[model samples]
Target: MKQISTILFSTVFFPLLQPVWDKEPFNISNISKPDAPFFLEDAGIKEQGAYFRQLPDPRIKSRIALSLLKTNNEKAVEILENMLRDEKNDNVISDLFICMYRLRDKAKITYSERIKKYMEHQDQLIRGYAAALYFIKTSDAATILTMLEKENSLFVQELLWNELASKPKSCNQEDLKKFLQSKDSIRRAGAVRVLALASKEPDSVPKLKKAAEDELPVRIALAKALKEMPDAGNELIAKLAEDKSSIVRALVASCAVSDKRLKTLVKLSGDKDWEVRRAACETLGGSKSPEAISALLARMNDNYEPVRTAAEDALVKINPGEDTIKKLTEFVKSDAHRDAAIRVLGMLGAKNSALDILNVLNGKAEDETVRRAVEALGRLECKSAADAIASKSSSKNPAVRKAVAFTIGRLGVASTFKTLELLTKDKDASVVLEAINAMGLIADKSFNKRLNEIVKDVKPSTSSDMRAYACWAVSRINAPTDGMMEEMKKLFLKKIIPMEGEKTYDADYARAAAIMALVEMGGKKNEPSMKAAKSAISFFHENPFKTKDEDSITLKEYMRQIQAVMNGTEIKPELVPTVKPELVTGKVQ
Candidate 1:
């Protein structure tokens, strides 16, 4: 018997592994050398060597190397070659070479010798990449076949089969078909991956039908590959609905999010195993179909709390019926789901539940419950609860106070302007900052008198972030341009050169925030606003910070639209989903 790695093959129940590039929880900010792209574009080539060495993320590091190598600068190429000589991190080397291999020309030519060595490495990941880079390039079929015979990892075997199937008018059909019957389950699963690419219905369908019964792993792999072979794959994924092993069935729950498989997924919601039912319920949460709601509703009473909660969450996500709103309102009475019920009702736009949610704020609820209730009422736009929300502006918890400030702004209750102003003067910097934002959202010209005070306070005594938020707040309120535009223009045009006593203020953070504010302030269609916007855009050209904050990255993506609004070509919508300011604290992009 051939020995197989259980973790690699996932012989037991485990979530399928996506390639590293496909994984999440990584963002553009995570790039250690964000200027790598800039270096590739300009005279920064010499500077990139140090940036590349200090860089931490492997995916970004690889791209930087590819970028520099693409520059064809002899110095850039020579620097990378020297770095690779001592590069001990195999992942870094493999990522670079794999990306290069995909380029298929100049990069592959330059890196061939080193990659050939990767082919001989014992690690299956390295060897798989090497084979795809080196071995698959050979016109000779026997050499590729010999490597396939010796390979053990399912991942590597899948890559090889995909490579072989992609070669036009090539690959011996009979030889590839033999793997479907191999005792090695990996080979059989590997065969399923390419069945969509290689075979005709008369031949492929029967082989898959037999392979379905071969092993659990094979059937699981078949479900994942269904998208590639829609014709035959659809029939196969449907058949997987009743697999004896719940693990195989659970794997298909995600597939059931599609209309084609949704009914089968709804059936899985009633699965005896709570895990299976939870999987189905969670997957159905993403579907907009009303039928998904009915299936999830049936699971509301599941004996397993997680399964029941999953059903509850699914209902909240799908925004359940009016009757369900009454049910959720009742859940607010119990401690077990009070916070969650308030959150669900608020997000579901449950206007009727606002009264029950409002009670949480008035009663002896926890700080967290109060915050959720406040936010829920804001989402429902319950103007009647504005007085109750403003009362919490002085709450002991800064977070609750912050929520109150944010909600008051969203409700835009002019009567509560005094409450927001009082909160802005509160001692806590974060709470005070949020209050200014709330005041801006109200945007009544009466607050224009307060603008001069906020402008004067943007000094060394204040923290950098507070100053940034204050600058942004005035722009949001669109305060009078007479005396204010001069100050705003000065800050917008000048860089934060960092005074000696400014211990708390970060010049860089303030700098980035100022660029954003000036752009927004410049965006009005009037001549004064157009001049303000054009001057700011010119200042940005000269002062573009080479390395940027995460916030700056988002602003750059919208530079064109921001310019359009400034140029009076496109009217900015009154409210749009993507362009909205951070709605709640801690939810910043």
Candidate 2:
């Protein structure tokens, strides 16, 4: 059995490398005539034959075949047939086969015989192409299986496997049962997959359970199969959880969502493997049972960072009763659990918890603890806590000041503009950047002159972030002064335009801000602004930004807006600064 498996693996898994033939035909209009073979223009058959006989580049020959077929010339079928007969280039032969398959329906009555002859061709590549074409037209699973048994090319075998697997309803239970007992692992694995898809049948459970007790690969496959089988019971899940393999345990943990499986997950949470524990925590977190919550809270002090983090997240989901809350409140005073406790309180979003967080921020707790507290207060958006948070803005610690600036912005309190303006010139570059960002959120035009000065400083010591945020802040003004517009254009055309296509986060942000500023300041009417708009289009084309959050436009949509603005068309309200009320409020809604 082992020797047969080895022979099957070697024969069907190591075929020659060839381009995959899955895509539809290329657009005919996109193909250039110059790419065609040199003999394509010759009217005489003899000259075309001569060119085919001495074809140097197979790609050029293939392109000629494609071009001929695209024009629907009467001679296209004849040319393809001749190329398939004599072409030594495997790539050219493959291309000819695809072209022939596409033109098969048009060939009418002769298509069957042509495909049959190619299936019997000595070259496996041609034979594989024929097999693919046959399945598309016939959907004959038996024929595909027969060809797969003899096919030596892995690519073709894969194509055949996909065809068979796609129509499992057509497969017989007896045939799938026979495949489960095959000596080859690939056959066994594929059989299990097909049976799992039809797992609604009473007999599938027995076969899957028998296969689950096999080797590691088969066991992993069974785990995946059972994930979709809603009828899968706790006994099978528990048995797999006890398997020596951590991966098997992890898989079991992922699917262990029912009440019966909760005990198994608790056991796996302490399975001596961090991955198993993390997976168990993930499952338990969603369980929302008191038992699961107890298990996660205990694991909060786990040795591994990821496990501890997972437990913290799981506790948040469960959101235990007052006793659990009281315990966490007391844990906040412990040096070891303080940070995690603070985070859990924030996630709970209870007003009472905000008091503890406020005390930490007001007192001289560790900088890291204070930072976490500030973040929690911001997340809660406790309007009453705004003054407490702003009191820390003048602390000598840059990290604390940075946190304060961010919290103020998050709160969007219009009263803090005076405090934010003072920190905009702090010695720390990060403090200055965050301050400028906060002021931009306030959206008052009074700071336009100060922001312009920051942009015009032009000193090598000026941080790019400060300049970028300054540009962004100036753009947020309800109406910009003439001098402000001139300064923004100079900063954009000189600094931002040249930084196009940069992959760094700061550079991308700066360029995006500069473009928005240019458009807002009416620089779109000038030549330099038009040039910058064009550059913006290319910049986003190369590096399209994507975000799961719906608050911002993706890079592709941003480019469309730039194009629209340049062409004197109205931009979408959502895509422009006018609709962004958060810009004026100094908060991200």
Candidate 3:
């Protein structure tokens, strides 16, 4: 009687299981909900059904169906039924079946009869989807495994294998071993992954090795599996490292760092392929051995920039002692390695290393090299070099002066404030900008009058950038007098606001600085100033200046603060005025 029922069900539904590929393409855009008020009891179902009908792509429709079914939406079953009746695409039917199978437990009675019918259908695609759904609903691994072995469609086999692997408790050793030996590469890969995750027993190593000999993906799987099985031999990894495929070699280098074969990884650092070399470098970076350090240093000048950067990073990770420092210092004399060595000295943070950088600064080094030296001194915070750095503030070259101003600010020596103040009047606009930024760092009240003078000197000849920096410098001073506040407001309303519509880069900068200054003065209380602040926000938000210049950093920061104040929140600490010096470019030391 049961056999007869199965036969009857197949006879009724087999015609519906025909692949839809031969039919006219279903127009997804044409699908719409019935306009007649056929109301669903659940409002959420109506909404979801409406959304499902709007999505022309079947893939998205399947996803929506799954989500609805997971929430126990019986209406979702009706929606899928409508789609199945209206659509004839095989792929669409397959996707719909998968969605139904996923929700089978919640709606088993809803889909059980159809599943049984489809499982017996002549169409391999339908049968595949039905078989997968049956196994998922029943946890009938034995039956599914039987179906999987006979399944010829790779897609169906994949669906069955994935369903089997998802329930690891249902997987047994014999079935997994058979999957590994299967002609399908995906099945083999899936089997290896499951075995590695579920069973780390030593006896599984040989089976994994045999599977590893199959192809690139399977070999990659074996490499990952080896990570779980510490007992796996290094011989397999060594063989994989020498594989002709660079992708396999790179993976082996990346994942096999724990293997005792450090020498093999070191050899791979010099690989012809750049990615393999980078992977080797990354692995070597974590290795504490002296051999890894030597290999990294050798590749520090690799032809590929990324490879060289990787090697440099690895060397830093080694955290070399005085011997390596001495070698690096000697290597610094070579023009090729001068910049890298200077940076390395900064990273080492050794007090004595500052002397090497100082010597380069005092000598006839290139402008770029001197700039690097200035940066290194600041990183080390070599306060003793403050006087020497201050001396360069008088240099005729603006680049040198700019670098000096930033370095002095970074060194944070009280005596250099005088020099920074003097630099605020420097002829070069960039130098003056950096100098005002430096004074903002020190926040010396003595510069108040000087900053005020710069703000007042908003002549047409004076660059708007200079005045913008002056306004920023004035705001940075703590507890400005009432008179200073009035002067700043006048500068914003008169000089800055009038230029807001000019649409030049400097005009945008001036307006942004002016807005920030106004917010700083008013806080949240001053109604008139807050009203102007809102206007400024609307102006910038609508005009939306392009963030393409160095000043954009400061502009974006000010915008954030203004918005925060308007929304009644404390200003973020990073944006609050402080003495933390940051690097800016223009001059060398």
Which structure among the candidates has the greatest TM-score? 1
In order of lDDT, best first, we have: 3, 2, 1
Candidate 3, residues 1-589: lDDT per residue as tens digits? 0121111111211111002111211111111111211122345555666666665676666665555544334555556655555555567677777666665544543444456566655677778778776776677777777766666777777677667766755767677788877777777876776665566452346776676577877777666655544444466767778888888788767754553768888988999999999989988988778788788777766778788778777777778888777877875676677767776677667567788778777888776667667767877889888877887777777888888887886787987878888888788877877887777666678888887777666555566666666666655554455555556555544434235455233454454455665565456355555555566566555544434453443445546655775676775433112211121112211
> For candidate 2, which ten residues in a row score worst on lDDT?
16-25
TM-score of each: 0.63, 0.61, 0.57
Candidate 3: 10-residue stretch with minimal lDDT: 9-18
Cα RMSD for predicted model 1:
12.9
Best-matching candidate per lDDT: 3
Q: Report the Cα lDDT for residue 35, model 1.
A: 29
lDDT of each: 0.63, 0.63, 0.64
Error of 3 at 218 (Å): 2.5
Model 1's alpha-carbon lDDT is: 0.63
Which one wins by TM-score: 1 or 2?
Answer: 1
* TM-score for candidate 3, residues paired by index: 0.57
- In candidate 3, list every pair of residues with a backbone clash: 20-90, 399-586, 399-587, 399-588, 400-587, 400-588
Question: Candidate 2 residues 258-335, lDDT tens each?
Answer: 787789888888888999899899888878777887788778778897887888888888888888888787777776
